[model samples]
Target: MTQRRTPSGQGPARRPGRTSRPTQRVRVRDTSSTRVEPRVARQARPVAAKRTAAQKGATKRTVAPRPRAITGRATVVIAVLVALVLAYTYPLRVYLAQESQIAKMKQAQDIQRRLIAEKADEVALWSDEEYVVAQARERFYYVRPGETPLIVLNDPAGAARDAGHAPAAPAADRWYDTLWSSVQAADSEPRN
Candidate 1:
């Protein structure tokens, strides 16, 4: 290794072919001129000793003696809170269920009341002689005096020979007429 020193004598030496390395300029304390007090020297302790003292103090404070009464009280408080929540849950659920049932029953009662009102109105209408006569004429074809009832025919030839006597009426009209005739006939029957 070759050492090439600077002519000024302050900077470090540089190698022949390589770049010069940077040197750190440290400021040294002039201890020969400064005066030190004995009290300040006694007060200063090493950093490791200071840290150990702080850690010992923290450990002493953290490990406090807790009584059994405080721990038992905390456990009782938690249990009571849980019991209160559980006790309220059942009654709350039952109340909600009953409320829903009441709503449904109210709706059903409203429907029933509406039906009863409609039936009562129908009964009132039936009690009127005009309404009854109109119903009998339209439904059963019960013609009054001097009123000719004309029966319109569809496939009269097919229907003519089918019945041994007269031409049969359309099956639909006959069914309704027969039912109405039976009801009227029953109402006219004398009760012994």
Candidate 2:
């Protein structure tokens, strides 16, 4: 241990090989020159001064507590989000509707394509000589090379039900009579 003398003629002991720790400097505020704002002075002022000081300080905005302003901002954000969702949804709804319509049209087109394919098959069948002759003989009772043809009769009950529309006859009747009757019906004027 070594003894160190201060400038004021006082002695303090210093330890050997251990440097002294630096002293922390603290700044003291000089409130003498500072202005006491009306807001800060309001709390410490007398009741008589409180009214006057509060009136004066009311115009200066203090640090605001956050919730009200935060809630207001949240409301605006929610409204904007809702508006944006609606704006996007309108187009999305229309897009979905159009997509559904396109799907329906495509389905209808597929059905029509199938019908066209069936009609094409019929045309191919009609182009064949055997198929044409067979259809003609079945539908119109056509005979080939002096072949004897037989006619099958429809039920008498069905023939009676259709009697009012045209003269109902058995399918066993002569083909020439049925053909002549159909020609006469076609040449007649349209009924009211």
Q: What lDDT tens digits, residue by residue, belong to model 2 across residues 62-87?
A: 35345565577799999999999989
TM-score of 2: 0.44
lDDT of all predictions, in order shown?
A: 0.77, 0.77
For residues 1-192, write the lDDT of model 1, one tens digit per residue.
534445443323443565644576977788798986665454554864776577643322223355576587799999999999999999999999999999999999999999999999999999999999999988998998999998767986677678655765656667788899999999999999
In candidate 2 the C-alpha lDDT for residue 191 amounts to 72
Best by lDDT: 1
Off by over 4 Å in 2: 1-66, 154-192
**What TM-score does candidate 1 get on C-alpha atoms?**
0.44
Q: What TM-score would each prediction reach against the true structure?
A: 0.44, 0.44
